[model samples]
Target: MRGAPTAAALTDRLTAQLRRRPVRAFWTALGLYAAVWWLAAVLTQLNLPLDAVEMLTWGREWQLAYWKHPPLPAWVLDLLYRLGGGSHAVLYLASPLFVALTFWAAWRLAGRILPAPLAALAVLPLVGIVYYGFTSPEFNHNVVQYPFFALLPLLLHRALAGTPASRGVAGRGPAGWSAVGRERDWLLLGLVGGLAVYAKYSTAPLLLAVALLLLCHPAGWRALAKRGPWLALGVFLLVAAPHAVALWTIDFLPLGTPAMRAAQAAGWVERLWYPAWFVAGQLVNCLGALLVLAALALPGRSEAGLGNPRSALGFDRFFVLWMLGLPLAIVLAYSLLAGQELETMWGAPYFALLGLAGLLLLPRAPSRRGLFAALGLAVLLVLAGLAGYLGKNLFEPLTSGRGMRAQFPGPALARALEAEWAQLSGGAPLPTLVGSFWLAGNAAAYGEQRPPVFIEGRPERSPWVDPAALAETGALLLWREDEAGRPPGWLAAWQGSLCPQGELVLAWQSWIELPPVRVAWATYGGRHCDRPPLAAR
Candidate 1:
């Protein structure tokens, strides 16, 4: 140009300009994510009480399968404890990190379906509203499950985009076959699916959705005909079989006995009411965002530009439905069949998918004024919602039960509890069981040695306990006075001396006799005689 600047000179100029264009954007985003998660971890750690810490300390390895959920999240938390020197701050980082990775993956996937600028802007709103600023340690599956969820869409996109001869695409023949055969893409998909299932059994619904997508689309059929889909199926089965077998063999299969059946029938009222309450809670948790977004991004809506056939028939549309609908379907089906309630955590993956959908709906080439106005409005709404939620629940106690009293005081409490326990035990082995509010268990950041027993009047169904039996080992029971309701009487039989420390009620110095406690009765009728009266024991 202009007498032809030397090729080398032109190249150098372009490279320099590109270099100057804030390459740190990636690092900056990652840094922000890490910083926020670290802060949440610190805050969560500070709020946990000693009882909660005890559960984190001593809950066993295979203790993951239970009536409520699978064990992946607990296992991950255990790993964090080992890596972060037993810091809750470290454990807290997990969700945020997952959220960040999800955003990144979504951005990449959006780029495949949208223009670059639009994709970036679309994700910005989600980052602000759905993830970056929100905090919840109880969102275990959501944290880990989302990253994998995002990845699935990306893989699907690649498989579709690849040439017919590529390894992962569907074959040209049958409706459900893979084009590239089973060795590469199918196996990879299976592995990923398996991992997702392992992370959260809730992910099972998506597998069916994937199958549906393949069957519905020509490209998907092509990929399937080549053995890729079958390989994926096999791998997924292999990965998920052990846990599924374990759940059936150890948990559900055993429940087939007559005693179990009677117990289940007896608790039908609670089983029904609680599940309804759980569903209601989830609706409130989303704050109607799911409904609002559905309205704004409804298919065939000209205003949102989602009606375009190209967009509607593409992989993006399929993924959007899969991500949002699969979880809802699974929860609804499970609730109807098993009488289980849906919790806020169960719906986390849906939020992530919703965020992706939102990004896909954003208009490309918006005028500067329009862009600023739209972003400004989004910012305002998000800030208002966040402020309102925090005002109501974060700072102020929203629930009448244990509420926010369970947060560990971070370094202060950890040091103090360790010191106190060491002195009390006189170097003897510390009792294995500690009890606290559910939130406290999350905050206390339990170590390997002392696990916290959650005493929220639901021990039989508690994540820390065996639904089939009462804890038979010697345990240190910690409880908050306000939260000290019915104590497990079986624990009293083992009768150890009580130690009342600051905000902690420690019970039992020696191994106690585990009375014949009925799991079904305990779960349904409440913890009647399972715990002794505070004074009587």
Candidate 2:
């Protein structure tokens, strides 16, 4: 009998197999990513992220924009949640969908510059990317921007890089075809770019990058002279017009909100230190991708210089450079000047094209086995991440006695409160909920009929709420028991004066038992919601 296959032989065989089936393997990897991450979301999280909860409440009502961020994400969540029969598990699907779009767009862009197989392999590092992996289950504004970021560059790249004929792609179209292609590309760019802005104002940085490139780069200025760009502008304005009108007429500016509860630093040391720290954090986030690329370079069975970035086949270096580099530079400069505290997640979309960047610039090109190994490394990273996440959320709560937000029994709390409200008020979704966004928002999301949260009773914060109607219609108020005296001063004055209901302590939904979460509920409007129109009784 043949000797048992050696480790080296098995590895070679697997790599050879991967090499032959790169496109299939590429798709398989993406599918695996989406499936397992969704699994993790279902298994690990109970309460969605604060952003997700906020969206859950806002999503109930549609608009071009919310008081905070764009409305596209909310629109998506609303449709997805309703489609899934109000099950929050479906919310997890959005993250995977956004990430897959980002990767697919990046893949298509890469294919233009690299071989089809290598293009597939180029995006393998994305699996190991932190934002795309460990923290991906949360569907929020940052998550929503992923596809827009990828597509923005891809559309711009295609528009600027010229058509199949112009790029020497084996066929020439009829005369004026290139001009038509450019206009078509511009039209698509306008559509994607417009939606991107509608997703978040943060898109300004990239748009600014494009503007700067157009102003300063030779290739960029030439493109601006074409009528295609003006057409793009008109399209963009048309898309933004609704929101722009809203902003212009709205009483309060929604651009900036209250400061974060986190501490800010001052003095020269902090200014310099904070920006540097932000940059360093980004690099650390990118460490996994770097390691994957480094691994690809580690010998075995790969060719060197795959897809030569130096190829004369029309890869707009300036377009790629500006798109990839400027947004981060703008952020870094802002942080340095403003001493703005940077949350790593804020950079979520900055590196959507990182895999493409590595493929373009990294000196070594992996042989098929090398590429396979890199993808394997990416799979390992994801599995290890998922395992750790599951373990932490499931087991660690037992020792800590306090569960993370993911451990909060959101649906259970909503169920209990709704039952009490129905018995008292003859059945409705409790009208509305007030108090902290966390508790009230959670109740609003899961409560019968999915009521809305007043969000601290601030009309601007919750423009959907008519204060006069809220006062007259009344709302059931909720706050976490542990945060007794923490309500806003005005809300606190009423906490004492309003109908003070008792507390409900519910055990966290984790493995084994952890300390139960205590939530206090009360009603405002008149009596216990059974009696009608009076004032806070």
lDDT of each: 0.50, 0.73
TM-score of each: 0.65, 0.89
lDDT tens digits, residue span 251-290, model 2: 4265663235223667778878877887788888888888
Q: What is the C-alpha lDDT profile of model 1 across 342-385, one tens digit per residue? A: 55555666555555575455443333333334444444555564
Candidate 1, which ten residues in sequence have the lowest lDDT sum? Answer: 517-526
TM-score of 2: 0.89
Candidate 1: segments with Cα more than 4 A from true spot: 1-27, 40-45, 49-67, 128-137, 163-183, 253-345, 359-364, 381-394, 397-403, 406-425, 434-475, 480-537
Backbone clashes counted, model 2? 2
Top of the candidates by lDDT: 2
- Name the candidate that leads on TM-score: 2
